[model samples]
Target chain A: MTVQATLKAPGEKLIRIRLELEAHEVREAAISGDFFIHPEESVSILEEALLGRPGTQEKLLKRLQDTVELGGLELVGISAESIASCALKAYENRKGPGKA
Target chain B: MEEWRLIIDRPGRGTYNMAVDLSILNSLARQACPPTLRLYSWYPPAITIGYFQRLEEEVRINKCRAAGVDVIRRVTGGGAVFHDRELTYSVFIPLSHSLALPSIRESYGLLCSPIVECLKSYGLNAHFSPVNDVLTGGAKLSGSAQTRRNGVLLQHGTLLVGADTELMFSLLNVSKEKSVAAAEGSPEGRVTSLSALLGELVLDGEFQTDLSMRLANAFAEGLGCVFVQAELSEAERREALEIEEGLFKREEWNRDRSIRPAFGAAGD
Candidate 1:
């Protein structure tokens, strides 16, 4: 399962990212951002949260929200709506029509 | 009294060394081996990344590959470290042991006291830095990391006897040129060598041997035990091979440097 999003600022290029999940833990994640914000620490925190746990859309969103809030990171130009929508799409894709 | 097993292994590759350490930790967890102390070295200097460090940002992969340096990821967490011209030590303690120190900091302090004493015996003022580093004159000469699982703790570190600082800088991502300029401009502290500490005592291999013995003895005495020289059991060797095959060799564990891209990229 995977979730992806692109965040862009006015007059700036878009930054794309994809989060792939496996067995409830984050298997691999890739990010290409127009602005550098030290993505490694954030990604690690996400990985730690996903490890050996059940990966659900709500759980994943909560993990990211909690980490960003606690760390006091600036989401800046990132679209929160896009993130939630992408996560839901990925979750739905993984669960299929009957399951969702 | 509890018996401490000592293993002095010949020079091996980095993967083998990590395998042995993990194997020892596993064996201790299973109560198949007594608390053990291992002294070993790497044949080709290796760059080991901490469990959490981004491989790309932490190591210069091309430089290491060109120099025939093996890169491995450790089960412990810390910054990346280059292992060359240094003695590596791993100590495993089971939770059931009466003398087992609680918490990472306490265990580091307890185990490193002997190293401090040994360095002092050689006329070098070495001190243990909080959170696991040994420094001389406020510059790190050794750094350690620990991992606890299944009631067993594995603490390991490098003792820099002699190192190629130029090569180290080339292999690591350290901004040495900038740091040196910064230091010259402001006199900031930097890494120091064991030879610098030994000064006139350079030619004395006997002193090094004595220091090693003293550290082993201190650990044994501190824990109310006798040191027993031993080799790896068949089970340990088997388990080590299995772990190496499974976790250590996996790209997901070692090369998946993407866990934190915000920090840096993956090492090639």
Candidate 2:
């Protein structure tokens, strides 16, 4: 099933996420935010790396950290940690309309 | 140290403005142009999203069109900005230029120092708010973006003279809480303008009265670089037109991947 969520962390970037879960991990995902990232083209690259990762903050953080450490991406106005957290927030929000 | 070529331009549409900046950037990259500083305004106002931003997520299409606000993408990376009642400046210099510095973070502070000083010339205390914002009295007075490519760096920013909180907030998406704050007056509650800060300093509240000349002079003094007043060369104008037609005018180019996959894409 397709899932979606929106998040705005005060003093932080605003993110909107959509995903299709496959076997618990993400099958397809799109992450768009008001944040700025250098090399602007690496946005999709980072998103691609996030796909198929577990839909949890810890797992996503580890994955994001690794991808960033690879040295191809440089994010501004936001960070990998925030992205990971926002991704989890999106996932969790999608799971429960009443809870989030 | 070379004297910078300073060009003051009248208000223009978003596409043409971006095209000129990019053209200057390209020329600087090739060493075919001298280090330059441009001061310009936007006609009918406009919204320029960061280079990587997904336009639909950041802007309200109907609101932008209804208000006659032009929408275009910047060659630099930053958040969406409402370019109204603002003095927008762009600087193009080689990476090896003395002011270029060794790091992007350092360069932002280095480049924006001129803005801070310019605000100071107005007798307002402005300081560089790390990462890339200029602030005074704890309120943001300016914000900037940068792009480094082809051995050159381009930095551009806007200093608010008179901000229309309602129009800007209307064309942008914000969190519910922030939206409420904006409705109350002032988006984010942290942005202020020269007019607002200097309520009685000038007779004209718009702050556009001789604002451009004041900024140009302040910037020249602050950067310690002399400005040789110049107009766009024929080559620059031609290049800008080429870029305007080839990229900025194309809907597909401006709206790339801005929409959610399920909902598809739409535009101005």
**Best candidate (score: lDDT):** 2
**TM-scores of the candidates, chain A only:** 0.47, 0.79
Worst 10 residues of 2 chain B by lDDT: B259-268
Model 2 per-residue lDDT tens digits across residues B1-268: 4588988888888989988888787777666668899999888788988766678877998888898887887767667889987889998888787778867778888888888877777888888977789988877879999877666788899988788898788898655645665566533436898879887664474456467667777767767788898998887898888878877877766787342111001110
Which segments of candidate 2 are over 4 A away from where they belong? Answer: A6-11, A98-100, B177-189, B200-210, B257-268
For each candidate, give its TM-score against the true structure: 0.68, 0.86
DockQ of each: 0.04, 0.53
Q: Best by TM-score, which number? A: 2
In the range B99-165, model 1's lDDT, one tens digit per residue, is 5665555777887776677677667788887656678776777777776655777778888777788
Give model 2's DockQ, 2 decimals: 0.53
